[model samples]
Target: MEKELETTVCEERIFESLYRKLSKSIHDFLYYKYGSNCNPNDTTQEAFLKLWKNCDTVSPAKAKSFLFTVANNMVLNHLKHEKVKLNYQKATTKTHTNVSPEFIMQEAEFLEKYNAVLANMKEEYRVAFLLSKAENKKHKEIAELLDVTVKVVEYRVHKAFTILKEQLEGFSIK
Candidate 1:
């Protein structure tokens, strides 16, 4: 008589197989979504652990979806928490730099002039400039957020800088 093969996939086998197959993809997903703010390795590990915990209910065919879903949710939660923390810090923090009265006054005047120039710039130019400079968003990201093209974002930002430079010709920050 011919012997039969064992076709049942147990939890341990699933963990080993899935870890090798899916861990890098999951890590790359988290890294691309969250950038450097989140630890993709840690998030990937947590996702795998959760998958192993619920392995009995999950099949190898469905494991990829399950892992991705878990990882995505965890990253979203982490980003939300980080936003809250950052908002709290911004609300409560104050700069305490020591400087002479003359330097402080010069700095304030420069800032006031800069703000006036920025405020007078075209709305689109100002928005692009601020998103690029203040928010540190990439041109591609700003373009996507504003529903414009990358070339448009680059042009607006450049125009804004040129306008500001001309408007603040005599002003210098100390």
Candidate 2:
């Protein structure tokens, strides 16, 4: 008897290929949608794990779509858990430094203001800003990652710079 043609993602080779091709995109999607607060890296891994767990049901052709949907839902569900967002934001804002107490206090105050301003900034501006500056992505790359025109990416980044400059008047990022 001849073996049946494999259609599902049960084959390790197929699964690996899908992973190599789609993982980065999925991670980027989650990051653009939720920022560091949602921990997009973890979310992407979980989405792939779900796909692997359901490999017998998910076809190779639909695997990409499945991963994206799973990741998006995972982040949304996580965001819905209220305290999780606050916890992540707080955790990220906290800092550990070996400087003098006065400097430490100043750093904490700056961190608090920075986090607060970021939290209040428009989501589009913040996302673009972080990706461009924190992540060190060029405008064209960010445009591609964000699925927008280069001009739009430039505009959003400019708006983000304006917000940061106004909000962090005395605090310079060196």
Candidate 3:
């Protein structure tokens, strides 16, 4: 007589099987979404850990979705906590000391000119330029935040640079 196979596997067995089957795929998915900044192995492990913890509620069939959801959330949380640091070097005229009147006047003048040019730029171009240069956001991130495409962001930023270059052609910090 042929014996019937088990319909329900034990939680441990199910977890192991899921891990073996989906870990690499989950890691690849997370890596693609988050780039190299996030450790895909760690995220994948954490996702499986969560699945194991909720094994009673999560079944083998549903584990893929659960793992992806957990991994995506982890990546987003990591991204949210990441800090973008910008190193700014101040431009100085050779003859002017830090506390010199000439330096202060030149800096103020440059700021005023820059502000004027930025104010006159189109809204979309200005937003993309600031997000890219000042905020240090990637084109993909900026596109998502602006609800536009990467091409649109690239186009706007290029247009902004063109306008600024034209406007500031004759203007210089002296």
Candidate 4:
């Protein structure tokens, strides 16, 4: 077992050397391909950790490609997990005000119409609308988060309103 332990330690050292050499370039490449929000630091760390854990399985020639593939998959998984979390948060965070039954009825009707209009919107438009209405995010903030122009956020908000107004027709909260 002592010889096996030594071999493992040697393998770990070699993996660390490779990781130190290739990490920056891989991170730069991923950042260029996927953009800045996806956190190159975390991705590179995860990729190398995977590589170190699986060192015996990875050949020297294919190691870099394996790292890139692992990083890319990590980024994709991160994006998907974020989407699921956002959707879950959006669903659960809605707060209903306690008011008169008549007022609550009106609010309910308006909510149904609002949801229907939102369903009709494109993902970008819907995202903007949710940020504006639910999160109360300003156009500048939404623009930064979505990586779009503030004017685009404004345009989407207006378009969302137009759609909602047309869909709701006589339904008024006030």
TM-score of each candidate?
Answer: 0.46, 0.45, 0.43, 0.46
Clash totals for all candidate models: 0, 0, 0, 0
lDDT score for candidate 3 against the true structure: 0.81
TM-score of 1: 0.46
The sequence of per-residue lDDT tens digits that candidate 1 reaches over residues 61-92 is 77899999999999999989989998988895
Candidate 3 Cα outliers beyond 4 Å, as residue runs: 1-10, 83-174
In lDDT terms, how accurate is model 2?
Answer: 0.87
Q: Model 2: per-residue lDDT, tens digit, 47-151?
A: 999999999988777889999999999988987886777777777654666679998799799889898998999999999989988989999999989899999
lDDT of each: 0.85, 0.87, 0.81, 0.82
Better of 2 and 4 by TM-score: 4
Global CA lDDT computed for model 4:
0.82
Tens digit of lDDT per residue, candidate 4, span 1-174?
565444531276667777888999989988999888999988999998888778777766568898999999999999999999999878866466567889889879877877878887888888998899889889999999999999999999877777777778774322
Who wins the lDDT comparison? 2
TM-score order of candidates, best first? Answer: 1, 4, 2, 3
Kindly state the number of residue pairs that clash in model 2. Answer: 0
Candidate 4 TM-score over all chains jointly: 0.46
For candidate 4, which ten residues in a row score worst on lDDT?
1-10
**Of the candidates numbered 1 and 3, which has the greater lDDT value?**
1
